[model samples]
Target: MALPEPGADRRTLDADRATAVPTMRSAAPLLKTSTAGALLAIAVMVAATVGAAIWLSIIDQRRQAQEQLTRQAHAAALQIRARLIETEQLLLLEGSGYAASADRFRRDMEELLDANPALLRVELRGRDGQSLVGVDAAAPRPTVAAATRTALSPEAAAAFDSAARMNRLTYSRPYYVTFGATGFDLMELVVPTGAVDGPMIVAVYAPQRILDHFLPSDQ
Candidate 1:
């Protein structure tokens, strides 16, 4: 090939440079657009991730709260069960003394009431479902009024009958009763004397006592 002039070579290089500049300028907008799109995608992804995290955190918190409530309920139930068992034992012990001396039986019941402030009433009922000897916390004195009184409710009657028939300890569902000036729900625990022809021991208890034992005052 024949050698070209230096000036011609310079002019050719200048023209090529001029064309390249415009090409680069034309591509700048696409580069900027791609960069902006990438940034927007990153922002959207970050927002989605953060929102998911917050939602998961809320769900987790709710789950934890439910678990805590469940634990509190279970603990409260256990405490109430234990208290009822103790009361049953106390009633059994006192009921056995009824045949020995009426005075002694009354004294023992009084002592039990004193020991357990949550005990609203204790009754020794005959096989006929007649209260033979009863001590009400409100009265403290032995009374036969409960003897003539029928079942507190159908549920209470069922609980009593179940205990007598099964010859085992049974509990009534929570029912509202007035104690002193305040009214709250309480449950009755029945302990059969195991003598199909004999009496049964029934004790009324405050459920709040068990909750107080298992939970904080604020709760």
Candidate 2:
């Protein structure tokens, strides 16, 4: 074979370069498109993962808050129940407070009223319901929660008579009273002082005051 001419070899090399250039240019666009698609897919996956993590955190926080509220409510309920029991014990055990002299009885009843926010009034009365030593809270003093109340409701009379005969503490049926300026839906406690035929201690409560003084805030 004749030796290849230098000019012909140069022409062949140039043709190969032209074809290769176009092929490389076409491949470049495909490579860039594939890279951009991959990047978009990764971004979507990352966003989904972050969203799931945030939602789970919010749920956990809500659950913890609910549990804390339940515990606080239960603790408050137990405290209120204990206070009620202590008041009943005081009524059953402390009768000398009513049996003292008039001045002493007034002072004692004053102290009792001051200490117990739920008590509206307390009175020392004869079996016939004549008021002796009386202490009235006279609250907000728009109306009087009176200690000098001589007339008794039928329910209060029945309870007083029973306590005098039985020589024990007794409770009256819930009743409404408009003795002073305002009205009250209340209950009475008739506590005997010493013997079956002796004098008695009478007390009345404002139920709303009991809830306000005893229950926890936000309840």
- Candidate with top lDDT is 2
lDDT of 1 at 164: 80
Tens digits of per-residue lDDT for model 2 on 34-107? 99999999999999999999999999988887778677667767876676566656655666655756776677
User: What are the root-mean-square deviations of the candidates from the true structure over C-alphas?
Assistant: 4.9, 5.4
- Tens digits of per-residue lDDT, candidate 1, 1-219, equal 988876998899999999999999999999999999999999999999999999999999989988888887877778766866677776666555664456776777778777775676777777667777777765542222464345555656789888888888888998766535656777788887655567787777777765655653324
Q: What would the TM-score be for candidate 2 when compared with the true structure?
A: 0.61
Instruction: Determine which window of 10 residues in candidate 2 has minimal summed lDDT.
Output: 139-148
Listed in order, each prediction's TM-score against the native is 0.68, 0.61
Per-candidate local distance difference test: 0.73, 0.75
Candidate 1 residue spans exceeding 4 A from truth: 1-6, 110-118, 138-155, 158-187, 192-198, 205-219
Local error of candidate 1 at residue 210 (angstroms): 5.7
Superposed by TM-score, candidate 1 places the C-alpha of residue 128 at a distance from the truth, in angstroms, of: 3.1
